[model samples]
Target: MLKTAGDRPYRGRLAPTPTGRLHLGHAATFLRAQERCQAADGTLIFRNEDLDPQRCRPEYAQDALDDLRWLGLRWSEGPDCGGPCGPYNQSERQPYYLEAWAKLRDAGVIYPCTRSRRELRERVAAPHEEDEEAEPLYPPEWRPAPGTGQDAQEPGEVNWRFRVPDGERISFEDELAGKQSFTAGQNFGDFLIWRRDGVPAYELSVVVDDLAMAITEVVRGADLIKSTARQLLIYRVLGAELTPRFAHCPLIRDEQGKRLAKRSDALSLRTLRERGLSPRQVQDMAR
Candidate 1:
């Protein structure tokens, strides 16, 4: 992942999931990404994170692209226009995930997990949130015996999790959120890189794609700070030569002061457009 002189240029991207319509949360993040790229004299890329075939639909993807264009956002490369590092969709990049999995397997930092949702729910306690909350961290005790060498796992089906050291402290500076730190065992435990369903987890795919796509800065909702910490661990284990900078935007909340969800049709871009709101009006409402 090393870049020679004149090889690195500021690059960023918007990764939208096709699970639902593009909501205000997405707009706030994408707008920030576009502004940052402009300020840095960089290029922007668009990527589709449609890893879940059951939920991801082509119509949703098209609507997302239309919404982005309706907002006057443009990208140098994306699924709509092919780039050198396409296909931009995560579902189409299984080869890269396989390669990374093999690397982690050879390095002995990965192990198979059999813990189910019920098991994790019974073990990991969810902290109460005044507004909204991120995904609960996993408990390391749920893991199988510690991985000691390469090829420890059978090729049979199982969730692949990366082994994180106990009490290891990780620190990183975010371009927007500033200094952030978290302890491995306390903030989160060993996490999944691949699931039994045969798709790479979000943590693995994001890191792999950012490095491979040469994304310079990751612009996302502040809700993913914990995920950032998780991905950081993977970057360390893989010895990534180019880890992108991060910029987490503030989340949009509802009347209850809770973060918005996909079901909140009132805040969706499609609804706003149907209400005769112009791009500038929607931008103003987003702010």
Candidate 2:
């Protein structure tokens, strides 16, 4: 069983993808994490979610660290600090994910999903055009059955998906958004847990990491609210004690009210540094 919040020491993390340069959104989330940790007298760990090796650049990873440092953010331990979680990069933790995947496989909670992205898009779009605004479009038999590897198959041949429990509501109290819930088999159907390319899916990896790190609270952008249900399912499957408290803050939008993206904006930390923006100034802008 997973331990309750009171049963564990307070621990949080600032996990960032190194696929792009650090921007205002990144700074804002990190600042919030730092403040929250300070307020609670807890330790904040820094992790690089650089699993997408193809898009993740070494320079970008270094730049992200430099950017965080420039923002006056300090982590108690990280990849550079050589702490207990020495390898703070996700890429280095593939073995752990593999082990977790095997466990889920043995439990018969995951299944092979042959549907391609294009096929899934068409499935979702077809219902929309038909004005059938109902539940997610997944065949009943397609869902994985607990303790039965009926859908399990060789990797690279088919993608893996988690079988969500039907008619069950996965609900949690958000530190900021109050009560949030999603009907398991209805609102969300079986979802991918591993890619065909042998990469551990984010939904699975994050849950495994959070449990391993003993994180007490999770504070992220409100955009990820939908992901809560999928994550909670993983926690339940693992028989974790209790879900961590969540605080999904508002996202930083541009003048056009669009979420900021690295490709479309010149808000890279290096660019900001070149413009002579001090760490404090950047942090203030993030706020």
Candidate 3:
């Protein structure tokens, strides 16, 4: 079993996906996590989210570690530096996700999705500022029966969807953004929890990791507020009595007012450092 906060001190984490180098936006959020953990006298953990086999590369992970160190950030435990969590990388933590999948399946909360990516991409909401990439909301009319009907592919070949309650509002108090709420079937409907490729979706992976890590406080970008709401429901279903306090930090936007994406290598820490900028200068720029 994963360790809880119990008599131990608070634990925070720096979760970085190795799809790209750490950009200023990521640096800002990471700094906030480091600051909050330090304030609480907690141990900071670094969890590598190398879930995507294609996008996440080994060099990118190394560069992330290098960039973080260059930016003067330190963590008590990480993939580079081991922790009690053992396998600090998500790619290696597949069994944990599988376990959670079993629980949700037993609870009859997940169903197979038949809709293809090409179909969803054509209708999903436009990209927003520092937020989850919006997937096309599966129309209420198209939802499939739990564990039975498939969308397009063969039975187990299709994706999985978690049934979100229609017309219910998920409300929570954010430490930085204050009170927030999103109505189900309005703001978001049923979302994917597992993919057809046999990989756990970001939603499921994060919640399961957080619980397993005993994350007492989650300090991430404001973009993830909706994610917190979604994960809150997962916690409820999982019988978690104590959910972590959430702190969504302000986002770092570009001059165009759009939130930065990994594609913007010009704004990445590597580029900035290569341009002879000091760590302090980078920190100033991040703010």
Candidate 4:
């Protein structure tokens, strides 16, 4: 039986993508995670979301650890300090991801996607009520018949997607954001779970890792509110008796009123520290 959140102690995580230096937006969101976890007297884990080999670098990962530490964030478990969930780095957790893929395959909820990236771009984009960065929905007419992927022993041969029930409304209550809702196939279509390049996609990996780690609450930026709706489907398909509660913190924006990105080096924690800013000063700036 999948572990239920009610039976476990409160557990939260700091999942940082090691694609670039940690920025003020990351600092604000992570600090909120620390505050919430401490309020519940819960354990906090540091997970290195370094699944993209081409983009992720060891130096960047090390920099994240250093920057967060310098910002006064502490965790009970992480890549640096061993814990029950040992391979805290996503790259090292492939076997776990593969297992979840197989279960999805067996359940007939996932299918191989032969569509290439270029072809998808040239086609009509999916109807979306989100930001331009949202992925174009997979054309429902292109789907292979149900059970088309059951013969594949390994998922790396082709990309795999979790088929969402079209037009069905997926909803969840966030501890911070409050009531939220989105319609499947409209907001998002069959989402990628495994890429043809042999990488587990973010939506799948986070769900598997969060459940495996027994996390009770997830704290992240508000931009991912739609992602939470998608993840709720995965939890349901995986037979999770109870899913983690979530807190989507507000994003830190730049002078132009655009949300901060990792490319904002001047506002990065490392850069701020280099400017002789103390941890307290940095925290205040993030606020």
Question: lDDT for each of the candidates?
Answer: 0.83, 0.77, 0.83, 0.89
lDDT of 2 by residue, 93-166 (tens): 88778777777787778877777766776666554422232235576765544555544443455688888778
Which pairs clash in model 2?
A: 2-240, 2-241
Q: Report each candidate's C-alpha RMSD, comma-separated, in the order given.
A: 2.7, 3.8, 3.5, 2.2
Per-residue CA lDDT of model 1 for 61-98, tens digit only, reads 99999999998899989999999989998889998988
- Please tell me which model should have the higher lDDT, number 1 or number 4: 4
Each candidate: how many clashes? 0, 2, 1, 0
What residue runs in model 1 are displaced by over 4 Å at the alpha carbon?
A: 1-7, 127-137, 152-156
The alpha-carbon lDDT assigned to residue 78 of candidate 3 equals 83
Error of 3 at 24 (Å): 0.6
Model 2 per-residue lDDT at 137? 52
Query: What's the true lDDT of residue 258 in model 2?
Result: 72
lDDT of 1 at 253: 91
- TM-score (C-alpha) between model 2 and the true structure: 0.89
Cα lDDT for residue 22, candidate 3 = 85
Residue 186's lDDT within candidate 1 is 76
Clashes of 4: 0
Pitting candidate 3 against candidate 4, the one with the higher lDDT is 4
* Alpha-carbon TM-score of each model against the true structure: 0.92, 0.89, 0.91, 0.95
